[model samples]
Target: MNILRDVSKLVCKTDRRALASLLKYAETGLKPQYVCKGHMSLASQTDQNEDLDKLYRMVEVEVRGNDPAVLKSYSWFTTTAAMELGITVGECWTPRKANHERLTLLKSVHIYKKHRVQYEIRTYFRFMQFLRLTGSTANTFLEYIQRNLPEGVAMKVTKVEITAIPSHIKTHSEPQQLELPATVEERNL
Candidate 1:
C-alpha cells in the first residue's frame, strides 16, 4: 500500500519590477537610468525585450516519492544544487502579516513530512542553465536527482515534471546615455 503523500507546494516568486530595475541598472551603470523610459532600434529592441521578458519567467519542477525522509533530503539537496548553479532561491511568504505569524508559529510547533517536492526556478538565465545542465530532458533531470539522493537514502521517484511559466510582466528597452567629461578635473570628479 502507498503511504507517502505529496507535500504542500513550495514556490519561489520573483519581483519582476525589482528584477527589471536591477537589470536596467546593470546595463546602464547609472542610477538615474534605472527607471528611465526609452526605446531602441526595432530589431535590437525586440531582442532586449525578449531578454527582459525572460528575466521574469519561471520553471516549476515536481518530484514524487514514497519516503518522506528521502523526499526531504532530496528537496534540501536540490535547493543547494540550485545555489551551486548560481540560481536565486527563496520561499514565497504570504502577503498578510497575520498569516506569516501563524505559519511561523505552526511551523515551529510541528515537523511536517512530505512525499512530493516542488519548487520554482525564477530567473531566465538560471532556468536556461538548469536545462543545459540537465540536458533539457525529464529523464536526465530525474537521473540527476536520483544520483544526488542522500548517501544512504533510497526512494523511487515515481514522476518528474518540469513546466515553464511565461512572464506576465510587460518589458521595454530603455535608451542608454553616456556623458563625457571635457576637462581632467571633471573626469576626476
Candidate 2:
C-alpha cells in the first residue's frame, strides 16, 4: 500500500479555522471572550461545530458577536475533524526551558482510538524541525521532543485511562509497531 498517499489526504487539506482554534486551546487553555452567536442554536449536536464552539471560547478572546446562542453553540469540533483526518487531540503539550528558549519539550505520545475515530491523548514537544512519524501513537512528535529538549527537561506522566471512549479503537487490525527515531534525548520530568 502507498503510505504517503494515504496520509497526505488528511495532512494536506484541513479546516483552517478548526485547526487554528485547536492549537490556541492547546497553548493558552482559556475560554473565549468573544460572543459566538451560533453556539446556543447548535448545542444539541455532538459534532465538529460543537467542537469549534468549545475551542473558540477558550482561544478567541475577542468579542466575536453579541449573540448568546451562537457563543454557546461553539462546541468541541476537535474530535470529529481530527478523526476525519486520522488525528487525535494531543494532551499535556507545553513549552519548557529548552535550548535557550528556542525549542519546546515533551514526553512520549499516548494515543487512544474508539469507534473508528482518532483523537490524540499525547503530549507535544513543540519545537522547530523536520521529522517523520508513522504509527498509531504520536511517536514522531515524541521524537522531536526528545531530539531538541536541550540538556535538561522534566515531564510527568500518570498512566490513567480517560473516561471518554476512544475514537479509533474499533478500526485497528492488530497490535501496532512504532518506527522510532534513532536518537532520543532524555529529560528528568
Per-residue lDDT over 1-189 for candidate 1, one digit per residue giving the tens place of the 0 to 100 score: 011111001111244554455445446654322222232222342244443212222334444433444545566777677677555554411122111111122233355643334443221111111332222343545566667765544434322233364575545477678988989999788
Task: Per model, state how many residue pairs clash.
Answer: 0, 40
Q: Given candidate 1, what's the lDDT at residue 154? A: 40
lDDT of each: 0.40, 0.32
lDDT of 2 by residue, 1-189 (tens): 242243234332445553354345436754333213333211232233543211110111111222323322321232233345554444312244222213333333453332243333322232111112133233433343335433223322222222444786556677789766665553322
Model 1: weakest 10-residue lDDT segment is 1-10
Model 2 weakest lDDT span, ten residues long: 53-62
User: Which candidate should be chosen as best, given TM-score against the real structure?
Assistant: 1
How much lDDT does candidate 2 score?
Answer: 0.32
Q: Enumerate residue pairs that collide in model 1.
A: none
Query: Per-candidate TM vs. native?
Result: 0.25, 0.16
